[model samples]
Target chain A: MCLGIPGKIQSIRDDAGLVMGVIDFGGVQRDVCLQYVADEVQVGDYVIVHVGFAITRVDEDEARRTFEVLKEMSQLDELEWMAEAAEQGMRGLEKPA
Target chain B: MKYLSEYRDADIAKRLIGRIKTRATRCWTLMEVCGGQTHTIVRQGLDELLEGSVEMIHGPGCPVCVTPLEQIDKALLIAAKPNVIFTSFGDMLRVPGSDCDLQQVRARGGSVKVVYSPLDALALAQKHPDKEVVFFAVGFETTAPANAMAVFRARQLGVQNFSVLVSHVTVPPAITAILEAPDNRVQGFLAAGHVCAVMGYTEYEPIAAKYKVPIIVTGFEPVDILEGISLAVNQLEERRHEVENQYVRSVRRSGTEPARALVQQVFELANRQWRGIGEIPMSGLRLRDEFAAYDAERKFGVGGLKVTEPAACRAGDVLTGRIKPPQCAAFGTLCTPERPLGAPMVSTEGACSAYYNLAKYRTADPAGAAP
Candidate 1:
């Protein structure tokens, strides 16, 4: 229940008195309660859903930015580790003390 | 899968691991407060990769693990009654009460149903007007709004037959309690992101300043967790302690306002007893006076039920991070998932169950060899 999934809103409707919508998770569609997030979401927007309720609307720009930053930082660190490892290997090959 | 698969990219995870290892000057004890994060960390061996640099102590954030035994006993008492249909999330059925679980109650002719949502139970109540429908509402703040909505809608629709047995807890106080422990070594925390996505990180701000520990609101993925660790390590290395948002994509400084408003309307904070750990002041949520009629404990008259933890279970120690699950004498011998001696072993999100389920994936060295 703690693992909320980010799903794209496919359509919106009012079920009786509550605001509801069909959200597409990957390809599977599940009806979700959108009343909590009605003010912030629209068709094609992404929201983090838990137990059939949309808790918070996902920021498309923010999501892309976070991934970009992480990707860049990780790549930079990978190069640093490789350089450190190469220096260590060179030292290992030097004359034994 | 746009947001899902990218976070699990292996190259990025490896790099984050290397970054965290390089950043930390010495071993730092940090606790990930959500069971979901624990599962990711253990499954990906993130803790082992940063072994010497970080000690990831699993916190008591699993609602099923921390739900007081007395509440379980009350649920059992209410579930076994005639004409009352007990509805709960699938996981709660297997959790053992004093002598039997909800499944056993169903085995003995009780009407126990597993529901994915509280609205389903409300629907059942509407369908069978003659019977009463009770939902076992259990989770952190991530779940409270949905449960509160059910109650709010029930009252609005004039559905008198639906009620809930709420066992909801919050994260900030739990962090406070862990910090106040005299022997605590936790220098930082990876706050559960989903919880903050509901309650926001504002509550954690005071906690970070007062305790002087970096609390990074973290997501439930290998790369997210590794980045959260790296962020916390950087703060500690520089003698800085603050609440930072590692999960900026899903969470905001102020969480969803509509959800919070509904929860505030239907529930209020109360002193609650954790299943293994003792009572923490105002750590749990309960129905407000206006909505007291929707409380199952009040409606069914099972509120007086109580039970104590078994002497053999070392769950208290495990839940508080004093010892790992395997450190307990009864970890494997007396407390298997098939027959859990304590609450932590009962839920998949639980740290004990996480240890038991993912033990094979872990490296041979229990001490966690350096990366």
Candidate 2:
């Protein structure tokens, strides 16, 4: 029951005094309770849904920091590749400037 | 999946294992205080990878495994009543009570259902106004928020027939009990990351300072577990004890305040009896006096039921890390997953079930090759 999936909110509604939303987890969509994140969540925001409840909103900066920590620990080699690719993309944009 | 799939990468796990090996000055014994962490460690063969570097002992973190037997009996008593629907998480269906479980109760024409959330049980009460809908609320701090919110909503909607049989526990108290034991050998702990996500790491700092053990909040993945182990090992090597967070992406230092407020509004502290371990003060959560009307025990009048565990089951030893699952005499012979002599063998997050299902630590070198 502790297992959670990060899903994007597709839609939200309040019916019979309950805040509910349809969250899309990968390709599957399920209804989730939004009482916990009702103040912060929007229709397009991502959330961590556990046991049919949206427990927390997803943060991009925190996600990036996690990858950076992994990189520092020599765990994520993909982060290095991603950084190199971003640098090349930026160079392409710089030549015109 | 963004934050999760990356942590489970095999290449990352390999690198973290190498780092863990280098950081280990000697064989250090560490206990992960969550059954979810135990399942991940065994299922991914992480323990096998860190064979000689460190020893990972399982702790009493499974809610179903540690739920007092009398609570199960009380749930059974309420479930078998006429015009009542007993709802619980799927894991609780097979957990044995005194003589029968909820699954058997369903087979005998009892109105039992499996719900993913307590809110669903409240919905059931709304649908069937004539029937009583009782939810088996069992978990740690990770689950109390939702359960509390359900009760709060039920009161708002005036859902008279919906109630909860609560068996909520906290992680910090369990850690203290384990450390205070006379035979305790745990040098450090990998605290449950999900619990920390709700209630924060502030409660763990005092425990770490008092017990003189590093408590690291960790997630349920290969890299997370290895990184937490490495952090704890670094502390043990430096002779320092403090609470650290390895699952920084999801968990904050103070946790989610709104969830904490909701839980505090609905529940209060109470002494509770664990299934194998007796009573620990301020370990369990009970519905507050204002929400007492929503308590299944008071509503259904099933409070006096009690049952004793079998003498053959040594779940207490396995829970406290005193012995491995294979060391128990009735482990495979009488306590298989199909017919568990104890709750540990039945719970999906339990250490014994993880070992038995994966066929781990069954070789000539028992105890998962721990020296």
Candidate 3:
């Protein structure tokens, strides 16, 4: 399975020298192995957990930037659609003849 | 749902689709090398929406679907033993082996358990020191690190009862296999984002160069996939072949170093056999010689069992994108999620299962994979 779900790390602790933590995935919580991302991730940080391991700590700023850019692109396209629709409306007023 | 729900934005997905349509002068056949992305494309009808612009070929990225029958038989053999407690991810339970599936063994009083992680199987070994716990470790690079850690931990703490039946396959080699095929029509690829998150995109640069194909490391969400398709289409339009990263937030160029390092420590490259596609040299991973004691095949003596694939199932064609699941004569009638003739139907992420589960694409959908 290649699917990795993003979740927030609620708490962290060492289990026999491995960095283990409880990851809250929106609501449900699971004990995820944070040893791979131990250096960069701490409590309250978001990470992509796959098969009980935190593969990477999600970059919040970068994530917000990516989403905002998508929204902006959508907004720009909406503007384009409005312009085309208005132009069509203007053309229709030229009369059936 | 902060990071996830935002990526499913419908407006963004539609805009990206519009952009991809505008950029393509001719229909480009692109393959998404992860079955998760295939599921997203089929479930959302993303392929249908961008019909003429792009053709999405489902690649052999489902681990359950591609894991060779011999390995499944070994897993079955081990599970059937009275002293062995076989554990695997839930999805692998129904994958049909040569004789039968792991679920059948479980039905016949076998101690088979579905574990969320390899570590959970290791925990079972610790809990019951008398029984031998064998975890059927099968997946791609996204799962290698976790399975590696389980073996490392077992050896570190002297947990002798634990071992793993590793059938891990990497993505790049499989991609190469597809591009090298004589009838290949794929011009670009959407690399599995999670796989890149573990192994990074550096390995893909050389592939893009030599093959002259664009490889976009993409995520599993609708918007993420559409953006990946958009990037690949843009590159094709300009005749630019390179490795692009559409999933910037989670994946880094170097990937998670610790995970890669640990996986390197535990596993090594070996010739692997894919169920439908036959053998691809060095496409799979096996536990290193140092961990032979933890290798289930060595411990159980089930390493030499080989069986032929049933002729009724055209998994090879479906896996290689030569034909769509619905195109298969046995797809819905002879083979199904209920009584799967092959692994593709049993696996949730398999292309066949995706096509079967998504009824909207069943009626010769123009956007569905070509014959």
The best candidate by lDDT is 3
Scanning candidate 2 chain B in windows of ten residues, the lowest lDDT window is B1-10
DockQ of each: 0.19, 0.10, 0.21
RMSD of each: 12.4, 10.0, 12.8
For candidate 1 chain B, the 10 contiguous residues with the lowest summed lDDT are B1-10
lDDT (10s digit) by residue, model 1, range A1-97: 7766566788899978899887765444656789999988899998877766889887766434433443422212212222332343311011212
lDDT score, residue B219, model 3?
A: 84
What docking grade applies to model 2? incorrect
Q: Candidate 1 on B212-238: residue-level lDDT in tens? A: 999999987677898899999999999
Of 2 and 3, the candidate ranking higher by DockQ: 3
Stretches of model 2 off by over 4 angstroms after superposition = A59-97, B1-8, B360-371
Q: What is the DockQ of candidate 1?
A: 0.19
User: Model 1 in CAPRI terms: which quality?
Assistant: incorrect
Better of 1 and 3 by DockQ: 3
Ranking by lDDT: 3, 1, 2
